[model samples]
Target chain A: MNCEQARPLLAAYVDGELDTVRMLEMEGHLPACPACTRAVRELQQLQQSLRQESLYHPAPAALRRNVLAELSAQARPEPKPAFWSWFRLVPALSGAMVVCLAALLAVTLNRPSGHEQLTAEIVSSHIRSLMANHALDVVSTDQHTVKPWFNGRVDFAPPVKDLAAQGFPLIGGRLDYLHHRTVAALVFQRNKHIINVFLWPGSEKNSAPSLDSVRQGFNLIHWNQGGMTCWAISDLNPTELLEFTRDFAL
Target chain B: MEARERLPAFEQTVLPHLDAAHNLARWLAGNDQDAQDVVQEACLRAFKFFGGFRGDNPRAWLLAIVRNTFYTWLRQNRPAIPTVELDDAALEVADPAAAGEALQTRQADAETVRRAIAALPVEFREIIVLREMEAMSYKDIAILADLPIGTVMSRLARARKLLQKQLAREYQTGGPS
Candidate 1:
């Protein structure tokens, strides 16, 4: 039980992983050795700093939701030879589960991209609102009406602008959830296609250009204006969607 | 689906360890954004092969998968990370000059600790995350990291020394004027 022998075991000793014999020998050597004592102290201090750093990053809220949603989707009966006949036996809950999974499959099947998942979430919410036939809480076509409608409903005022002159007219707005908070969902229309613009509070009024993404055959454009994070999603073509954002920001 | 029963069993055993999985992934990925991706990928892999899980020490099982997912993603995305094993050949000696000054700053603040941990090469970095952060036993880390116990022990020692040196370097550069 000397310094060289005890030196290699110091880390294991500190971790309480040493066997009884090695632990006792290390204990015996440490009382006589100042060097080993210092090493032990330094290791302990490092552990303390690490633990106190708040470095334990918890699973983000969205990860939990996405995983659970995915698990439900994963829980499907094995395929029968008569696949068409098997469809009839799927309980009502499982039937809804399939649709839910299908919506996520488009996003989750891709490479693990947080940005992709977020866009998928936005598109999913938009489709859900239309599916549930609850797209707007306050159905007004005026900018004044839609803007004021969000005053008491949400913590911040969503920037609502009328863009009828640009051919993308304001339909209405509603309170919807996204990015872990209640956001302003402003519905608009370009010709026959519907557009859902989701807005939440943002720190910087980014003057940088808007970034656009296409998901599930829908066009999306995101920008930050007036301390609000805004995303406009639509079935319209990308050019029209970009134009729609430009008009709204005007 | 007959296999539908496995989902609940998987969630009960695996989902509760999400925080552990996240913490390990975050430290390995070096940022919140990539860490989320790593965790998601790990969860998928865990779900896919969960029927084989014997179910003891679920956190350790999930953590092993998380570590594997991170390395796989790292190789694919940042092939820059050396694929060869590091063991002793990669063990970096701490800055000799900062050693003395580093000792005085035993109470290195949280931000310094974070920077020090993040600065270690991925080889040393993973050891610290598993041993110090996760509080995993040496044997458990040996299994999770797929290394001999001696290798795990030596690496942990070197990793701590490197971490201390990193903290000391910070102290020397930015110590009180």
Candidate 2:
């Protein structure tokens, strides 16, 4: 690959967007050509500075508040008219409405694999739990306090293990509603990321050996163990999240 | 589904990406206040079309809306600034040490880097921000930017080329902050 052939691909090469074949060809040509090497280094540095610099502008708190308020205001349905409430008392119509609701519930709950809806629910639960004063129902680093805290609140004792020595410290536990049931959410901190581990008794349909998915940039991994279905979701990278699951299960 | 019914899911899948949207909008619209307006308007548009969002990557989906909203606002509100500014001073002989200056001084301040990026043409600026700052893959960027994969790569290359020259000049001259 000479300069003309290589120059067009040089940026892609530096960006690591080149396919393996093209990348290796660039690799072979780069060291031999000083111009391309300089170009490559410059591009790499530009990319580095762009990434490392604090350039990301988070929406202002006021903006966030206003946007949500605007959405809710726009989405808010007007109050139903008085006649609609009176009409609902008609027996046959009310019976049909009940059937319509049941059908809607069935269709909503019986998603293709149940995973899609459940994943969405889990992600929302994770996000909702992160809100201030909602993350923990009982704050404790001791497994004793956290594990038993779920006993009466939820149907089962969620397995609570603190892998603080492994870099995932037990933070606390919260009750989160997901998958049509209230489940115990065990919270842990891995550096800056909060990992939410949700557990409930597994029904026959949703249990799996292990599964991994990425939803809205959050990493989620779930599996069944000891008759309990467990989902661990966080912003942590997959490898560490997998490690977290392994350590938690240990 | 009605907007009221879909709002919760929208908050879950779409709203979480506000920072990403704001970051992109901030770069594209050129100021925080304008960016907020763009975000607010884009999200309202997003809610209007939320029923059609079937993809899994809501961040990318939200970003696409933000970009489109920004362009529409740009068309209506502001006269087009020269999208491409060829730096005539960039004709000076390339400094041999300039490429390495980033490593040496880390040679620019954070503000300098931010200004350098902001100064890039929108075509180049958006690509660099998405690739470097948002950390999106080229494929995702292609989808978000509505460009072919090849275009995404080449534009990124060209953007970096211009940025390199610009930064090198800034460092070598210690150009005005």
Candidate 3:
């Protein structure tokens, strides 16, 4: 076969897609034809370079968590209303149970306030950043270095401090978009666990000094100081997280 | 199948291909954020309809879903960039002289290679990514790309030739060694 016939077949030939007879014909033709030979070699080199290149990006851990979380949520069995229906049949106990149920339902259905919602957002974001293996945009242990890195990234100056002497070393900071606005997420390391402290400008003056909550297996502490709302979240024990927050707050 | 049985089957069949799915999405979507979004949506769809899956090749099946998801996303998010049919003639490497520049292409760095592949049209880009980077066979690519084997082969040829031309141009323009 000449160059024209061989030209279209070269890719298949290189890929081992050709039948044996065709492969033999192409192999025989390659030694006699320099141009076809050069094309085949070029195709091989391109394939090699492509394989060597870092082209395949693994799905980030956050994506895995998000997808798995969504799958588990979908797979979760629907709440069994049959059990509740059976509980409603006892007329004598129904009066007391109905009142108790009303109070319980009221507590369960109450929507979280803006601050509480922000706390949940903070914990999820912290988990996502860690799971995504993007824990820090600027990694440093020095307080001076971590503090200045957030300049101009957010509207307010985020307070960054080193509590390494107290066992919480400042790791770095990342710019996070939370609650429909950009906020500062300062990272600190307590032993092996990471603590994400999200800071943003406070909306209310002289708000409560501190509030603590837990959600989705994470502990969160929120506080307002000097016109900034700061939230520290981690999987670390609540006492340790609160201690770290206290040192930073002071 | 019951929901419990479906979960295990879906996990066994589809979850192992998460990286492959994300890799294709990342290349197609052109960024991490969009790639993640596309993969998430694709996984949800895969789980929802997994009961209907009859094919034996789960990786290819997942990849096909990813390809479809990416297109739908492109259509909704980027209406201006129509998914135009790429002319095979336009992608042909006319200059036979560039074939000799294979040595320079061999020296091409990862960034240069990435830029060259990124410059390809979506169809060409997807084929090359599947065949070369993902190391999928022509038949498997045919399955994922929803094309005949001949079409897959010719498109791959055209894609490689386009890459050669791009690399040659880079060398001509003094791309980093």
The candidate that wins on TM-score is: 3
Better candidate by TM-score, 1 or 2: 1
Clashing pairs in 1: A77-B1
Q: Which ten residues in a row have the lowest lDDT in candidate 1 chain B?
A: B95-104
Of candidates 3 and 2, the better by lDDT: 3
For A170-209, candidate 1 gives per-residue lDDT tens digits of 8888888887788889999888889999989885757533
RMSD values for the candidates in order, in angstroms, are: 30.7, 36.2, 33.0
What TM-score would chain B of candidate 2 score versus the native chain B? 0.87
Which candidate wins on lDDT? 3
On residues B29-134, what C-alpha lDDT tens digit does candidate 1 reach at each position?
A: 9888899888988988888889888857888899999999998899899986665466665666754333744654467777777888887878778888888878
Per-candidate TM-scores read 0.56, 0.54, 0.58
> What does candidate 3's lDDT look like per residue over A108-168, in tens digits?
6797777777777787799888898788999999878887888877777888899999999
Best by DockQ: 1
lDDT of 2 by residue, A1-250 (tens): 8889998787677667789999989999988998788767666666667876477788889988998999998788975667768766689878988999999999877764677889999998888887775999899999999988887898888889999999999999989888889988999999989999999987545444254789999999987777788999999998899899988766
Better of 1 and 3 by TM-score: 3
Each prediction's DockQ?
Answer: 0.35, 0.30, 0.33
lDDT of each: 0.82, 0.83, 0.84
**CAPRI class of candidate 3:** acceptable
